[model samples]
Target chain A: MNRLFHLPLSPFSRKIRIVLGEKKVSGVDLVEERPWERRMDFLLLSPAGQVPVLQLNGTTLSDSTAIFEYLEETIPEPRLLPRDPAQRAEARRLAAWFDIKFQREVTENLLQERVNKKLMKSGYPDGARIRAGSANIKYHLDYMGWLLERRHWLAGEALTIADISAAAHLSCLDYINDVDWGRNAAVKDWYARIKSRPSFRPLLNDTVPGFTVPSHYANLDF
Target chain B: MNRLFHLPLSPFSRKIRIVLGEKKVSGVDLVEERPWERRMDFLLLSPAGQVPVLQLNGTTLSDSTAIFEYLEETIPEPRLLPRDPAQRAEARRLAAWFDIKFQREVTENLLQERVNKKLMKSGYPDGARIRAGSANIKYHLDYMGWLLERRHWLAGEALTIADISAAAHLSCLDYINDVDWGRNAAVKDWYARIKSRPSFRPLLNDTVPGFTVPSHYANLDF
Candidate 1:
């Protein structure tokens, strides 16, 4: 049986879950882990001690990007990346934008403070950080709206890892009620389309202890 | 003619430069860009305003990881990632270890304080950050030494993107005389092999206007 070490609120972990769902890979035993605990056994399995570690094909794989790429190579059905090299690079580029940039600007600021701190029993959330995250997210929503105006999905006509990556981060923020859907109609529309996918259903059903999900999070028409 | 927007000490940019050299890709113009400046033209090319942005095959590409993967797909000579899926995953895992983890723990604290501060005409380097970066790097070097104690290269028996990514960051740190070569014999040995590559020579020769190269910076025998 393929086992996965993951966390509910981790955007990177969420990315793999969506990818797994998109690929229709069933029978994956999702093992929720708190990487901050630094368990010796888990550390042995993943040296970096980050989540979304997949134990498949008799190998242990960590790093969400590496895992995603491996899955792409091993299971090429309904390709997450485009066939053309240029389009594929663009997809990967957009994926990086969310994973690295959006993550640093919005997710880390909002989710890390509002969610991870409470889960880990850490200190109270900083007002400065929350304010910064709130301000930063507006710019990002505008940017996404700008992109979605021309393209059906984040990258192009078809759904790609780019959309999955962005949605993964946005979903986590949305859980904390950080996303302002009214900020950009195009972005909201894009999210609504992706949110309706079967692959994204599992994430909506997830209920993190002590944290309540916003009513619209699970709504297909959201 | 193909053009590349790069910087002398940006580890991400250096990764592309070394990759280009390793592939013997010539006749490309190198344009140095300071992303922090937020230049309108550069931002148009890279919405993220980061380097190294490569204009090749009549397209603009950003995000080092995305660009590297694109180059790997288009130019498959002397593969940087292994053929086997597991090994390829391992290679990418190591690459991210440096690009994300090490970049945060060490490079951002040290280089961003030491180099970027001076270059950007920002305030003086913070003593706290420099000390923190200095302390944090030893742990990473130890981690690399631990890995090198087993594998010939970072990923396995081959010179992969893992080596290039690690070397790119360390090379920048070596410029500021931050890396302690004596702390880890295996890491030093591994670096010696990589630093001696023709691809690495250009990086060794690079000079920033306000910074002097350490005496042993360009020497292969260091």
Candidate 2:
């Protein structure tokens, strides 16, 4: 059986889970790993000591993006990236925008401070960081709205990994009630569509011990 | 002509430059972009406002990894990624190691402090950050040395994007004389080999104003 070491609340882990769910690749043994613990055995499996380490086909794979690429190559149904090279680049670029840029500007500030810190018992959430996260999320939501206004999806007409990546991060923030869906109607409408997907269903059931899942988080109408 | 908007000291920019050079993709009109200035035209091209934006074949692409993937898919000759799926994953994993982990732990602490601070006029170099970066780099070098001792290249027998990514970050650190190359013989050997590649030659000649490149920086024999 394939094994996936992941954290329920981790966006990167959620991204892979959604990807796996999207392709209907089931039977993956989901093992929740707290990467900060730096368990020696886990480290042996993943040198980076990050979450979403997939043990598939006798291969230990880390890095969510690499894993996604591997999965896409092996399982080509419902292609997440567009066929055109330019479209593919756009999909990847937006995926990266959420993973790298939005992660830094929003997720790190909100989720890492509010949820992970408490889960790990690292330290009290810095009030300033939370404030900054609150401030930054507006810009991101507006940016997403702008893009959605222009296209059906984040990248283009076709649903792509860009949507998966962005939704993964947003879902995590949504769990913490950090995202104000009302701020941008387009972004909210987009999320409502994403939330209804079967691939996103598994994430709705995810529960982090200390953090309460927002009531609207799992609601299809939300 | 195809255009490349880049900054001299940026590891991300260097990664793409080396990739372009490696595939012998030439005649690109190199445009130095100060991303910090947030030129509206550049922002229109790259919403992320990042360096190493590639304008090729009427496509405007940002995000170094995405650009590399596009190039790899389009230009199959002298394949930078291994043919095997698993090997490709490994290459990508290590490439992310440098681009994300190493950048945050080492390069951001050192180069961003010493070089970008001056270029962007952001602030004075933080003593604590430089100390942290200096301390962090040793572990990274040791890790690289360990990998080199086992495999012929960072990923496997064939040189891949993993090497290019690692070299890109190391080259920037090398320019600032932040690397203690003497600390790891295998790493030094690996870097020496990477430094001598024809693709690497362009990066060697890159000069950033207001900061002197170390004497050994451009030397292949160093």
Candidate 3:
């Protein structure tokens, strides 16, 4: 059996969950981890102490993008990455952008303001930072809207790893009403379709302490 | 002919340059770009205004990792990525760590205080951001020392894309004397090997109009 240490709201963890479900990998135990608490065992498993560490046959893998690629290569079923190298490069590039840029600009802000504060985690919320996040998020959302307008998914017509990465981060923000779906009808529609998947059902049900999701957060149609 | 739009001292750009040289790809015409000048054409090539955009066969690709992967796929002569999927994943993860985490901590500080401040091209520097960058850089350097003690390269024994990514960033900082080589012997040794590479020659020679590199910048054996 494979074991995964994850956080309910972590975008990286959600990327892994989506990959696992898409790949149809069964018998995997998902353990919710509070990384801030800093469990010694978890630290051993992941020196960085970040979530979405996959433990299989005594080998522990960290980093969501890395884990996703590893799973794609190991499983090779319902392939998330394209067989063509150019397409694969495109997927990886989009995944990196979402993981690094989107997370920094938007998701982290929402998490910091909503979850981190509630959790009493490190890093205080500055008004300027939050405002900057909000402003930056609109630009990203507009970019996504442009991409979604041209393709069925985030990267392209194919439902590749890029979609999963974007969805994971955006979904987390959506839960806290950080995303303005009203900003782009195309992006909103795209999210609506992916959000209805069974894999996303668990994510919608996740309730972080002291944080109340909006009414539409769990709505499949949302 | 392949075309590359980049700033000489930009770490991301330097990484691509090394990869191009390592792969033995020819017909690369490098153009130095002034992103802060905000040229309309440059903006069209890359909306983010970040450099290291690779132009091949009428297709423009932004992001160093993406461009490098594209080249690896197209050429695949001297591979920067690992043959094994797990190893490849590790390479990508470490590359991301250097590009984002290390950049936020180390490169951004040195670039701002020592480079950006000197370049009247980018406007005045923010003291608070520079101070934060300096503090963060020391912490990152400490982490690098710990990692170098365990592995020969940033990621593993064999030089991979991660090594290039790390060297690119560190070399930029080295130019401005931001790095304390005496702080960690292990890191210094690792960097010395990287600095001696023929591919790193172009990076070391890079000079800003108003700024000069440190006295030790050109000494490969230093």
**Candidate maximizing DockQ:** 1
**lDDT of candidate 1 at residue B59, scale 0 to 100:** 82
> How displaced is residue B25 in candidate 1, in Å?
0.6
Candidate that beats the other on DockQ, 1 or 2, i.e. the better one: 1
The 10-residue segment with the lowest total lDDT in model 3 chain B: B113-122
Candidate 1 lDDT over A1-222, as tens digits, reads: 799999998999999999999999999999999999999999999999999899986889999999999999999987999998889999999999999999999999999899899888999998899999999999999989999999999899999999999999999999989999998899999999889899998998888989988988889877
Top lDDT model: 1
Residue B97 in candidate 2, Cα distance off native in Å: 0.7
lDDT of 3 by residue, B1-222 (tens): 679999888899999999988888778899988778889999887756778888887677887777887888888878888788767877877887788778876677668666766664456767777778767777667777887899888777788898899888888888777777888888888888888888877778777777767788888677
Q: Give the CA lDDT, 0 to 100, for residue B71 in model 2.
A: 96
Once superposed on the true structure, which residue ranges of model 3 sit more than 4 Å away at CA? A121-125, B117-132
Q: A32-64 in candidate 2: lDDT tens per residue?
A: 899999999999988989988999879889999
Q: Runs in model 1 with CA error above 4 Å?
A: none
Query: What is the C-alpha interface RMSD of model 2?
Result: 0.5
Q: Relative to the true interface, what fraction of contacts does candidate 2 keep?
A: 0.76
**Order of quality (lDDT):** 1, 2, 3
Return the DockQ of model 1. 0.93
Candidate 1, B1-222: lDDT as tens digits: 699999999999999999999988998899999999999999999998899999996888899999999999999997999999999999999999999999999999999999999999999999999999999999999999998999999899999999999999999999999999999999999999998899999889889999988998989999
Computed on C-alphas against the true complex, the DockQ of each candidate is 0.93, 0.88, 0.56
